[model samples]
Target: MSEQTFFATAPAGVELLLAAELVELGAATAQAARGGILFRGPLELGYRACLWSRTASRVLLPLAEFPAADAEALYAGIHDLPWENHLAPDGTLSIEFNGSGPGIDHSHYGAQRVKDAIVDRFRARCGERPSIDSRQPDLRIHAHWRNGQVTVSLDLSGDSLHRRGYREATVTAPLKETLAAALLLKAGWPAIAAAGGPLIDPLCGSGTLIIEAAWMAGDHAPGLLRSHWGFSGWLGHVPALWNRLLAEADERCAVGQSRIPPLFASDHDSKAVRATLINTGRAGVADRVRVERREWATVKPPPGPPGLLIANPPYGERMGETDDVSALYIQLGERLKSHFGGWRAALFTGAPELGKRMGLRAHKTNVFYNGPLECRLLQFRVEPEFFVDRDAADRHARAAALNRAISDGADGFINRLRKNLRHLGRWAEREGVSCYRIYDADLPEYAVAIDRYEQWLHVQEYAPPSSIDPARAQQRLEQVIAVLPAVLELPPDQVVLKVRQRQKGASQYQKQAEQGRFHEVHEGPARLLVNFTDYLDTGLFLDHRLTRQLLREQATGRRFLNLFGYTGTATVHAALGGATSTTTVDLSATYLDWARRNLELNGIHGSQHQLIRADCRQWLTRTLDRYDLIFLDPPTFSNSRQLTESFDIQRDQVELLRQTLRLLAPGGVLIFSTNHRKFRLEVAALADIHLEDWSRRTLPPDFARDPKIHRCWRITQS
Candidate 1:
């Protein structure tokens, strides 16, 4: 047995930073390499690396390197290696193959060849082979093949180092553990925390930044939380030394004084506060970090000489297809400019629109790619009178930089949604089939509207912090939403309040649509009762605007059917679209009544629409009406008895398709649709009917990025 060299991986762009960290932790001449630093040392150094190095992803020990021209050569090279040296009879192993040559074009196939070589080597000698555990493999064999040369090494990190095992709970947009450490490193929070200042994150999504600060400030090692390290099962392992190192790291930490220096996190969400609290506790930093639920307006700048005020705010685009949070960002800048004077802050965001919303020029911006998105961390120097510059050149330079860096990996929630929304929106528009955007673009909300298609990005919405003064935050949210269009230059008619609807008594004849050009609007064939003012919105949902239009085109001379027909907009469109008769179904009594009123307002008689008050799916099964053209749009996932029957588009789509297909007449179409964001159709299973995907073709210009807001399939027997 011999002690050899190893390389621990760090994320890209942070290799030099990690190298510096390794050298500072007392490693011998750490040289910065590709993924991480390369350092030659004893067993003690590897243990120290696990305990002390905060930036390293995983450490790997290279067992052998051989030149192979083909698959047979690769197998022979791996088969000859001593596989039992690293593993006992009970040891389990997993293999990861990274290929870059034509000899092994398929990664899985290459990995299989390597696995066969290893098992053959073991079985020929000992008549037994190791088990494979993809999740918790004791010895992970990592193979890197470049230009027909294969290098196989045992991964020392049993699992990804990002699995800190400390985050108890997380809200939407939780930062990866490795990424959190890197962002803090870039922001230079360690030096500031050590120099006697509180480490603060105003929009701490999952307490990652604050916990990282506490760990750094207290001199705590991150690897202490994880019980298993890849080196622990290796040759010449030192359990005593590892425990001692952990103990020493623990002894070295001290509680940060509340007044001297502290770690603080704030957000305007209550659920996020709970998540942060749980996360901090799991991280063993709950006592050290203080979290608050606060709106930006209520938040005070750091006390005691104005320390760092780093915020990863909502840019309104990354996580979902919505950019309505522009006003929130602009308001954030106003707050920081007025309240957080004499403070140095770093704003990590992926959206350039957010920087413009701040209405303040950034001092420095760093370009970093968060996956596919090219994001930036904009630095700002705030003083008593925040930068009131006098130049066009600076503005032009800033604009150019902002345009160049359109993506962000802020680890904070705000920009994630902004980026997602932008990507989804752009995708839909390019396909030229937009109906209505499913974004909550209330300016104050910093959203357009989120659709099922946009939900494919899985953008998370933060549960508001517990400490937010609801009255103040709500008022601020409304004000920001109301004033957003002035700067955006979008028509008020184009911008609708996405409000929740509730039922009312018969005596309460609520004022819905009144006299104005807005009072009555027409969509080709159907007349709509449009109300742009009062409350968050009117009866019409623009996302379904195109769906309604499609229903109108398919309604001519057929017995039209509308299920889950909220307010009967589709029904009215069907009747006016020249349908012989329309049947509408819903569980809401008020909505059914409202639907009737809407038709009456448009001079279309209620007799034309047979309004049935019952659960749509239940009504479908019980009724004997075989319609020529049926519009069956079910919720992505609904548990309510109204349409429930455990509706899931991805899982039950085939069954529902079969059901809808039964209702269509020969040569007639059944438009089967579901708004489930992640719904994927199995075209082969539904081969009985001809399927035409009309999602992109039916979209409106505003909601073009995520065309699958809900997939519209026209199925008819050819």
Candidate 2:
């Protein structure tokens, strides 16, 4: 009957949108405030907002304001309210207190004080106090304290307006209904739908965006799907007026359903497709929304004019997923350019930088918050002008500029690299080596390890010390990378760059990339698979080239065992060297798979070559099989979860050596090696065993500069 002050709470970035929405919903006056909107409207208008304001989380009607300088003041301020007028003495209630002030530093304490004052007031007045009901309350009171002032209000939208009651099933990280609506509104979906444009969500998780879009386009009230509201049990709720509004909404929805546009939803995951189908049925948009299970790469537009294509693709927030995610964005851009010309596209992502990888220029950008994560909606017009070929043109430009910079200076580094290449290149060709180290930190100013894997170069920048300026280090690295392509006569993409740091345990085995690009390289008579991008170390260890050769030469008729057998390079050598059988042990399933591939590549498989996935230390104690030849190269330090106890080369070498020697038959040879630079053989501890230093013999000629790269010992039972 009369206009009252009302507050509608929304997400931080959605306040302006919510303000505009409330004004359109017949509010007398609406101003966007921090975190919410303040408006003046009649009771009927509030009911309309509750039904139609898709961006607002809740609507609160203020009843009183008072100063609460302390706890007693807070109690007195709340107790002074006319609680009986809002709720019956025997009814249930809940208080949601927010903000911190002089006396209320915690929300729970403030809520407790407010609840105590109300129940105490009721008890003193009628001797029957209302009980607390958190889930469903007759009266939901909200109190805000700031600057020692409290504003109390009655919450008329319960359980967050985003819960439209249609999402009975959901997938991981489903977008909230309010946020989805905000994204659609920001993308101008309403204007597009008004012109009879179709909508498609190729990576729909649970169909939140499609359902929200359908409701917006069809003039369907979001609250109509909801069964209950905060005012449903409130004493002041006018049943007749609310029923009149419900009838009006029903009639509008019935007529609007026919005006809905064709909406399509799909996902690569079958579970996600099923979830979308279930949610669409529950949202009553099943007939209007065509849902399917399809991969993003295969999804095509419906046979009609271009429209809006929006998606919330996987952000790849976890480790080891960046490369795949980047590739996905690149592929998505290619698809858009090749097929969806003239279509409007919007991609909402937590990683805004990834949006650039899409290879399309975003003409417009809008910021939104998905809970605590700040996200961006990148808007693009899929046209020829917006297409960006980052890999071809941009990469060439960068390389050309880098080459120009290098030509101006950097003679010292270039001369040294050429000298090493001329000398080592000849040695590699002479020895029939396809993979070998060409340079190892040759110049202190340019600290990097450059290895030639056929025509490709794998350059590892040794992580500079903390004292070195990082900017200077990066400049040196860029200069080195720039000059490598020209000096080596290889394409820029053929050169892979990575930072090499001190690795402790299984971290060295952790995936650095997911490119899944593996190249075949030859060593002696064996062919092995080496992945330059996916790992810290190429599957084949170049430093072990000479060692694997010696094993092959000595394995004509003996059984060979390879421990800590990463990728089983040494096992491949033994198998090809005519060993009777080969067994390779490691802790990584991924590495084991790689080993299987390597063995298969060399035409060595079946019972003769065994690949076991187990901690080398644990596996050593379990195996009773003896071998005539064994190679053990454990990490310097490993605390992998698969191990019962952490292994340190210095601390556990004695026991590890003993276990391996026990598996060694009489007169058998066991070669032990470690890259721990400071490692020393504890001779006195192994008094009964015979040990000889093979480090000098095992060290390859290319690694002569760094003899400590690895230390090998020939061990035998006394």
Candidate 3:
């Protein structure tokens, strides 16, 4: 057999593991590449990899490489390839094209072009083209374009090796099979399994990890369970060689199964346990692998020496989940310390900090990408020597110091907070509100505003003056974090902390985190998605609660427009208020998507509700569309590069109001608001326009505690 170059795809962090597996499988050379591995070897090496490599998602053999600067060139280049030599003209195939350079930007379009070239070539030669089969295709072709060069390959390991012909069903956040294999390999499970020690996955969700471990221990080829391979349909496939390999695999599987060590799997969810059983049975390891429906808190070690106790536990990636599972990690740590003392534990999680909460030091940690989330596989030797409590004690001591310092002002702050919550909670309940401010710097030392959104809390620490010690300020903030959860009867993780510095311009809109988690909260008749952790401010403005209500109440059968519509909460209120139509304008695509989701959540969508992604200032200047009612809430200062110029509300309010007034219909009310603490309405500059201060009346009861929360005014050009 001649030497051939091949590529094997793996999940982001498992690329190196896949490369190692390839090297072990007798590849002449294997090197890690982004999302996969590149290697050079004989054709048999490729076949062996496709059959046995556990970490590889796909095995690809390059068929052709050519310059494809444009779609036309891509089509011509692909069409010139000897398609008939790879697949029968009557066979079905699917084309997967990725990457782009100058002219090609869309993957779907690129895939279509490649598909057209293949079919056109066959049609021209044999007067018949292969049928397109997206599902269960006879052949799979992958195209990669980079820097005006395209590499077209034949996918020998069809339908990602992670499928493994198992997993009839799955629960939420199911671990991909290949990733499970990678984690097991990284944890040195193979050597442990060979020692005849029992393996356990107490938090197994669908048993991907356990099954992969079982196969590794038994020396059963991971590909034995798969029913289809891209090479099966290829004209060039050496069936005799493949069958010989399959026979050898079967013989090895029989011996491996007999030598397999005990495997135990358990989960709190019965559905997950059942799923594991079904999947393991399909993988031909059901009899060897025992699964039980058991919670992590009570899961005991298997009745033998511990091999590897590995699990892909629920990693609380989102805010709500983080709060919900913080205690789970703590409990898991306690379990490891008390029960699984001699076992080596490999725990995979998104938030590595949560692992610290487990109170055990990790002996080794490997970074892996589980989908879009970068995760850590923490390897721990669950021994008495590793269970040091010094870190925990120090953490407690510092928290205690901060608590003591904050106690100096805690009495006044807590009393003020309770007073407001009592009065405002009653008012909010009576008014059907789920989100409202509970405390707004009631004590100067506790210069933070706390808002309750249903069960979650958003705490914004106001940047203190330079005269205040930074250390003291941080201590106070930490104290607030420690006490607020207990005071609010919520989990400590439920309290999202943010520093609210005076944002000069558009810096406030810059993402602080990319959690992409949004919580739906109610304000009167509308439902809005309020994100507490991703920005300096929550998507829904607590201070503007009453103002949004007013907009809803007065917007019936009127055309409504919301400027600077952060997350489009106000638009939802207006639409709920029976606004005939609404247009929401904002500069951030993130906020626009949020607004769209908000409207969709409330079932308020279609052409009647429009979301525009543009600087509100620029849009207002050129708009011919007039609204019967308008709500303009400009930022205090915004120098977003998207805008033609920087915006300062105080300096540009007159011009902005004038432009807005021109778009207002007769008798239409244009409501403007700002959060600038010292903002003043330029009454004289807009004397010709009808203006009235609604600042006092629009203040929600919760916001009244802080008089400088916001300012509002009603303007009309009548």
For each candidate, give its TM-score against the true structure. Answer: 0.59, 0.82, 0.63
The C-alpha lDDT values of all candidates are 0.66, 0.87, 0.85
> What does the lDDT come to for candidate 2?
0.87
TM-score of 3: 0.63
Pairs that collide, model 2: none
Give the winner by TM-score.
Answer: 2
Q: Give the better candidate number (1 or 2) by lDDT.
A: 2
Evaluated at residue 282, the lDDT of candidate 1 is 92
Worst 10 residues of 1 by lDDT: 453-462
Pairs in steric clash, model 3: 505-637
Query: What residue runs in model 2 are displaced by over 4 Å at the alpha carbon?
Result: 317-323, 396-558, 565-580, 586-622, 637-648, 651-655, 665-669, 682-705, 714-718
- What order do you get sorting by TM-score, best first? 2, 3, 1
For candidate 3, give the lDDT of residue 137: 89
Output the better candidate (1/3) by TM-score.
3
Model 2, position 6: C-alpha lDDT score: 88
- The better-scoring model by lDDT among 1 and 3 is 3
Kindly list the per-residue Cα lDDT of model 1 for residues 29-49, writing each as its tens digit. Answer: 777776677776766677777
Provide the clashing-pair count of each candidate structure: 50, 0, 1
Top candidate, metric lDDT? 2
